[model samples]
Target chain A: MREVVVPLAQRSYTIAIGEGLLDRRDLLAPIVAGRQVAIVSNVTVAPLYAARLRAALEPDADCVIEVALPDGEAHKHWGTLNAIFDALLEHRFDRSAILVALGGGVVGDMTGFAAAVYQRGIDFIQVPTTLLAQVDSSVGGKTGINHPLGKNMIGAFHQPRLVLADVGCLATLPERELSAGLAEVIKHGAIADAAYLDAVERALPALLARDPGALADTVARSCEIKAGVVGSDERESGLRAILNFGHTFGHAIEAGLGYGEWLHGEAVGAGMVMAADLSRRLGLLDAAAAGRLRDAIAAAGLPVRGPAWPADRYVELMSVDKKAERGTPRFVLLEGLGRACVRRAPDDAVRETLAACAPG
Target chain B: MREVVVPLAQRSYTIAIGEGLLDRRDLLAPIVAGRQVAIVSNVTVAPLYAARLRAALEPDADCVIEVALPDGEAHKHWGTLNAIFDALLEHRFDRSAILVALGGGVVGDMTGFAAAVYQRGIDFIQVPTTLLAQVDSSVGGKTGINHPLGKNMIGAFHQPRLVLADVGCLATLPERELSAGLAEVIKHGAIADAAYLDAVERALPALLARDPGALADTVARSCEIKAGVVGSDERESGLRAILNFGHTFGHAIEAGLGYGEWLHGEAVGAGMVMAADLSRRLGLLDAAAAGRLRDAIAAAGLPVRGPAWPADRYVELMSVDKKAERGTPRFVLLEGLGRACVRRAPDDAVRETLAACAPG
Candidate 1:
């Protein structure tokens, strides 16, 4: 097992990444504060792992309740988030009770958000089942639901008490979902670590093949980078914005295409490519480095080309992104292969990048 | 104007309490950051003060948008909150844009919550018009919408950038609404200060008669106590829970009676009497002190006796209160006249208090 501690002083928590760590009572005991536990999973994950997690927690918890929501990114909204609240209230789960989020990103986000607003705030644990969640969403405290107008427009920065990412859970992830997770893995490397990016490129084949060591290593490294970034700037006041390297464009893509149509990682994968192209256009990143980053993303079975939306349409959508301050859209572009910086791109340069990277 | 600084480190803010402070451009200028500002007021407050606030902010802000929501506690829900988000998105309000809550507690709570969850978080100021809001809700950062199941159940603890309590606005307030605000004023005194409580008791007639000096002093003193409590325990982990002295029973009364039937302060007024009775039963408060507390509540033109809900029903309702932990309802009971302590009352004792305080 590998542990990466997010040093947030009093709100600090640990992300435990390993194979078969789900049922570890020792790992779950310290964080599970109250006797009552509500394991919030989705329909897809509930049928598979909810029972196992419940059994694991049964001995420790006085009342182990399960609320399995309908699965999908489309289900990530007020209605679904309220269902978690309703269940918590129905079961008489109090502030001291722990809410265990036991699914993928959608589940984790909604559960974390539910915990954030449930009775002002409650302790919650993230048990991410997919690689996308394990490496990205579960580590950071950015939990929220999407609005009709914008993705993640409504949410809170509520950190979890503990995050348990079982590498073995990845065995069940769909191939596309696994690839989607790699999009964030590649993002972590593309933003901060060149050696990690090189390692990811070398381990692509093994990672796709579900090699336990490669998956564990990748998850641990991604979480470490994320934990480090999140630790320094918990509220995204400055340095933390780098983590959204591809997210502005990715969010626009997700919102434009409709939330559930393209998985978050898929949009991020394509968005990263567009961002690199924009970086190259701005003379911040050399063409060869941008090309290499695209190659790595593609090698991980992720998309390099964005959808053929008009440049103006993309601009319009991106302008509404959360990263956009005042009226200017802030893009997290690569300074080189391994470093990211937030910059406002010229309209023509953004247009050129859109024109170059859009699908023919 | 009197300023009470809530010393919450970087998130610290001030409550500026005075008469006619709303139209003072000097007070609103420093806190209202960003060019774009949205004044979230209700239908009632729109005609009254929104224009004055907009006129004051116009000199500093480039764009001042007004969103007038339907007024009342019933309107404090997701639909209304989403409307704020929709307007923000439609108008393209960014993270840097400011949302000024220009109404009563409902407006302040919803607007603060909207700011909290809007684009992860944004800055908001509270221009509390009602005494309930000016003295209480606007000072602390307890912003949220109510759920169908509970009051203030779905929300975030997002503090305002500034709180402007214009004592002059109280001139237009309904007599009942003015009295409702007094409940919170009484609560601050009952929980923290004996002298403040005595002053409130003595100033009841003048306060009810809308004596500006008396009202300002009362609001300033109440805010001072609240600012101190909130600064020490921002997240309600320990000392802050004392601020909810009457709130546990108050919330149940509000929820049980169907929100809006009785104003929040009215419920809290009766709830405080019940809490005092329970404290006396626990031997923490003397019967004479409890009676004096009830007498003061009545003197403030607030309800001292609660509606006759069966004891079991009160127990059931209070059990689901956010303050309840691990299936036990935590009551913030008065220790004699001034100090407050959080304690779990025996079920029968709580039942007795309910029976004693319930209307015959």
Candidate 2:
């Protein structure tokens, strides 16, 4: 198993990565605090692991409330958040009580946001049932619900008490979902670790085949890079924005295409491609290097081009993204592989890249 | 003008207590960072001081979005919180933007909660226009909206960058409103300062008349006591609950009174009498001391008897209060004058207190 501490002092928590860590009583025990725990999962993940999780927590859980919300990123809304609160209030949970998030990013993010706002804030443990949440959303304290107008437009950075990411769960995720998670993994490597990028480049097929050892290492390394950045900038003030390497264009695509229709990882995958193309268009990246990024990303079976979003629609959507300032879209770009900066991608440059990135 | 710092180190901010301090450039200058500032106020407050405050902020505020919400505690809900986010997104506010809260506890609490959750978290300044908000809600970082099931049930301890308590604003306040503010002032004296309680007993009429210096000193002293407790325990983990003084029974009264029926202060005024009477019954206070507490509160023209609420309803209403645990209503009882502790009041004590406090 691999462990990463988020270093937030009192709010500091550990993210455990390995096969079958979900059943480990030691890790989940120290965090849940109470005898009663609410395992907040979604419809998709409840039947799969809820029983095993309940068994694992059965040793200590005095009373358990298993709340299974409907699965899908689209379900990460205010209504879902309210449902979690309702469950907590109905069961009479206290400050000492805890909520266990038992699914992927949507479940984790929505559950965490609910925990953040329920009774001002409460304790919650992140059990990232999907590869995407394990390596990304589950680690950071960024808990929020999405607004109708934009992606992740509402929330708070309330850190979790514990994160138990069992690699075994990834076996249940669809191939496309696995590929989607790889976008974030690839992002961590591209922005902070060239060698990891090289490793993923070499091991794309094996990693895609769901090798447990490789899976643990990739998720852990991604978390390490992210943990370091988040420890310094928990709220995404500066260095943290770099972690959103593809997110600028990614969020725009997600909003433009309509949220939940496209997976967050998929949007980020395509957003990374546009960013690479844009970096090359600005001459900040070598054509070969840019093509290598595109090649590596494409080799992993991810999108190398954004959707057929129009220049104006994409512009309008990007203008509402959290990073925008005075209608200028903020893009986190590569200074080179393993180096990044957050700045506005000039209109002319963005337009040129969009034109170049068009399907031939 | 007197200044009290909550002393939260890097997140530390000052609570400036003075008459006319809201118009003081020096006080507002250090806090106003971003050009696009949103003043989250209500309909009542906006018409009263929004323009004057706007004129003062012209030098600092680049773009001001004044959100005039429906006034009263009933409006302090997630719907109101959503409105703040809607305005921010509509204006495309960046992370650097600051939120200025210009009203009583309701507006201050809701705006602070919005700022805390808006875009993960943003800096906010509290321009508390009500006596209640100025001396109480503005000082504590307890920003949240009320739930249908509870009061201030969902929130965070996200402190403000600056708290501007303009004593001059009290000049335009209604007699009932000013009396309501005095409930919190009385609470400070009851929980932490015997001398201040004595001073409040002597100066109720002058305070009611809105004597500027007396009001300023009273506000400053109340702020100092609150800041001390909060600095030591920002989250109401312990010690800080003392700052809640009459709030245990007080909040129950407000909740039973349908939240907006009785002003928070009016409920608290009656609650203080109940708490003092409960304290005496518990043998922690003398009847003479209790009489003084009740007499001073009555002299301010505030109610000292419980509202026309059934015991069963009060029980159900207070179960949802943040201070309650496992359906046990935790009361801040007086160990002696100006000293308090959170203890589970015996059922007999609460029932008898309610029976004795009936308006009849």
Candidate 3:
């Protein structure tokens, strides 16, 4: 397993990436701190892995409880977050209580946020079962619920105490979900590591074939890159904006297409392509690289394009994205693979990018 | 003006307490570091001091936007917070945009929360126009909105860079509100300083008469006591819970009677009395000291007894308070004047206190 610490003092936690590492007492013991445990999972992941994760947390812990939320991005709202709070309060969870999120990005985000608002804040562990969470959301401390007006419009930059990405759990993940997770892996490459991008491109076949070693390496490398960026810019002050490379265009797609209709990472995959295409159009990137990027995403069997929702709708949706300033949308544009900067391109360029993204 | 610092590195700010701190550039200068300002106030405070505060800020700043939210605790909700966000976003507010919250606790809590959540976070100043805010809420980093399920159920610990509490502003406050602010003033005395409590009792007449020096001293002492408590226990791990001396019982009153029925400080005033009485009953407090504490609040003309609310209702409301654990209520019981501790007293003790609060 590889470990990457996010460098936040006191609130910092290490991300553990390896196959079948969830049951490792060495990693779990230090973070849990002899507190009562509450495992928050979802219906989909509960039956598969919750019991095992709970059993593994034990022999040493007591007063443990489990509350499973309904699975899916659709449930990442105030209601779902309240259920976790209800469970915490009902179970008498206190400042010392530890919440273990045992699912994908949705569970991780919601559980972290619940910990944040529950008595100002509490400690939570991220046991990301999905690849998307393993590399991206699980590493960053951003936790919040989606506002009807925007995605991730409300949240806290709450770092986790520890993260355990048990790749063994991924065996039960749906094919569509696995494809979605790749979008984030691709994001790390696009923003900070050209070599990693090349590796992902070259090893797409083995990674797709669910080769455990390749999958684990990709997750760890993605985490290492993210941890470095987050360490320097914990709250997306500057360098972290690069991590949102395709997110500006991607979030617009998720919102314009109507949320839940598109998996976040899937929208992110298509969004990365849109950003690359825009960079190519702006002469900031090579057309060949853009094609390679798009082809690799397509080769992974992820959607590359969708019917154009109105450009205006995309604009409206992007306004509420976390990267948005006041109301003006901030785009994380590429200088090239492995380099990104935030700036406002010409309106025509943004409109054109939206126009190009329309279904063919 | 007396100044108190929260002492948190990078996120720390000062609380300036005096009769005319707002008119002084020294306090405002350190906080308004930029050329643009956003003064978030309410109609009640805007007509009174917005122009003056804006003038003080404008000499060194430009493009000031004054967004007026409806005045009152009833408006401290998600919709109102969103207005602040919308205005900030609508104006292309950068991270440097200074948000000045220029009203009482409601405005401070909402705007501070908005600053905390807006674009991950931003700079804000607390130009608190009410005494409750000046003495308590304005200095603490606690920022959030009341959820449908609980008060402060959604929030972050985003501290303001500066707090300018012009005691002169309190001159225009209505009598009921003035009395309400005294609850926090009394709270400072109850939890930390015995001499301060004696001084408050001695100076009650002058304070009621709005003597500038007397009022300013009260405000300064309160902030100093709060800063000391907060600096030691920023996230309420221990010492900070003492600051909630009246709040545990107060939240129950506010939630039980419905949010708008009693202003927060008013409920806190009554709640303090009940807690003191409970502590007396528990033999953890001296009966004479408890009586004196209750008398101090009552002499301030604030409620010393809770209104008739069902036991089940109080229980339901208290469970959602920030101090609650699992469905169990946690009350901050006074050991004596100037000292408080968090303890789970018996249900019978709480019932007796409530019975004492029943209208004859």
Candidate 4:
């Protein structure tokens, strides 16, 4: 077991990475201060882990409620998020009561957001069950639902009391989902640690085979990098924007593809390649470095090429991204391997990159 | 113009209280940093001030979009909040884009909450047009929509960049609406300032008549008290809970009456009396003091008696309040005149107070 603490001043918390953390009653006890607990999960995850998690919480909590939302990115909107609230209010959960997010990114995001707004904010715990979530989303304080026009357009920066990333949960993840999670793991390496990137490249086979040691090492390293970044820039005011390296292009792909068509990690996977391509064209990154990123993403079995939307359509979709400031789209670009910066490329350059990177 | 600065460390902002501040482009210019602006108002307020506010912002902002939701507390829910997001996304409003809330509490709250969740938070300005909003809601960082089960069950603590409390807007307010606004004004006095309470009692006729000077003084003093509390405890972790004095009972009344039946201030007006009754029964407050508080509330033309619901129903409704902890409802009871404390009274005492305060 490896524990990394995100030092966000008073809001700091720990990310516990290990196997079979779901039954770790000692951990579940201290973090959840209240007697009432609500476990928020999606349909797919609830059937798998909700009961075990609930039973773990039962000895401490007087009451344990479960809210199972429909699974998928399409359901990450206001209506679905409200269902969590409806259940909380129905069960009369108070501000001091704890909410445990018991699924992947969708469940974590929605549950975190539901906790953020439920009675003007409550404490919540993240039990992220997916590699993508464990490595990335679960560590950051960002929690929100999607707007139809854009992905992650509605949300808040609500930190969790604890993030229990039970790598054991990943054993049940589908091949495609596992591959998608690698996108973020790869992203953490590409943006901050060359040595970590090399380690990931070398461990691809072990990662694909769900080797416990390899999975744990990868998740812990990813969380350490993320926690370091988040601790410094909790609100993404400056240094944190680097974490969104491929997210601008990734969000466009997700929104352009209508949210669920391309999974978030898949989109981010291809988006990372496009960003690297753009970085190369902008004279910020070498073609060799860009190729290495593309190779690692492809080797992880995630998409390397984004959908061939018209350049204008891509621009239109990207314009609404959260990173856009005063009509100028700011993108996280690689300056080199293990280095990232948020910058606005010339519109023509961005459009040309879209044209160049489109599936041929 | 009286300005109170809410010192929330880095998130601190100024609350400008005066007459006709909506047209003060000088004040609006420095606060609204972004060139792209979206003004969120309700139908009732849009026709009255939307165009004028837009015109004030025209010279500074390149594009100004207005999203007019249907006016009323019933509309302060997810459906209406989604419309704000729809308009923002449709217009491609970015993180740098500013949202200006141009109405009473509902519009200010919805708009502030929209800005809070819009791209994980954006800068927003509050141009509160009602006495209630100007005096209370607009100054505090409490922003959210209500859930079906409870009032303000869904929300965020997102402070505005600037609060433009135009006492002039109150001139056009209906008599009942004006009285309702005074409920919060009275609450501010009852909880923090015996001198302010005396001033409110002395100036009740002028306040009822919508005298601009009286309204300005009342609003400024109320904001001063609220700003002080909010600055110290932005997330309502401790000191800020006192600001919720009467709100637990008030939210129950509002939720019981189906939101729009009684204006928020009116419900709070009656709730304050119930709280005073509870405080008196608890021996924390004298009957004479409680009577004085009730008389002032009545003088404001606000309700002193709430609906005669069963004690169990009130208990059930109040149980879901944000103040509840471990199934025990914490009521913000008066310790003395101009002093308040949150304590869990004997459940029977609460029930008896509810029974006594109910309309016979």
Query: Highest lDDT among the candidates is held by which one?
Result: 1
Kindly state the number of residue pairs that clash in model 4.
0
Query: Lowest-scoring 10 consecutive residues by lDDT in candidate 1 chain B?
Result: B319-328
**Model 1, DockQ value?**
0.69
* Tens-digit lDDT track of model 3 for B178-234: 998898899899888999999999999999999989988888888888888888878
Worst 10 residues of 4 chain A by lDDT: A319-328
Inter-residue clash pairs, candidate 3: A89-B326, A92-B326, A308-A359, A326-B89, A327-B89
DockQ in order = 0.69, 0.72, 0.34, 0.72
Over all chains combined, what TM-score does candidate 2 have? 0.95
lDDT, residue B248, model 3: 77
Which parts of model 2 are misplaced by more than 4 Å? A309-316, A343-346, B308-320
User: lDDT score of model 4?
Assistant: 0.88
Instruction: Estimate, for each residue in B1-360, the C-alpha lDDT of model 4 and write its tens digit.
Output: 988888888888888888878888898887664468999999899999988899889888868999999988878888999999999888877777899999998999999999989989999999999888888888768898877776677888888988888889988999888998888888888889989989999999999888889988888898888888887777777988888788888988988777778888888999999999999999999999999999988988889988988888899888766577756788898988889898988988998998899843
Model 1 chain B TM at: 0.97
Candidate 3 lDDT, A105-147, residue by residue in tens: 8899889888876766778899999988998888779887776
- Candidate 1 deviant stretches above 4 angstroms: B248-252, B308-317, B326-330, B346-356
Write down the lDDT that model 1 would get. 0.88
Estimate, for each residue in B178-268, the C-alpha lDDT of model 1 and write its tens digit: 9899999999989999999999999999999999999889998998899899888888789998988888888888878888889989999
In terms of DockQ, which candidate is stronger, 1 or 4?
A: 4
Clash pairs, model 2 backbone: A35-A62, A120-B155, B191-B338
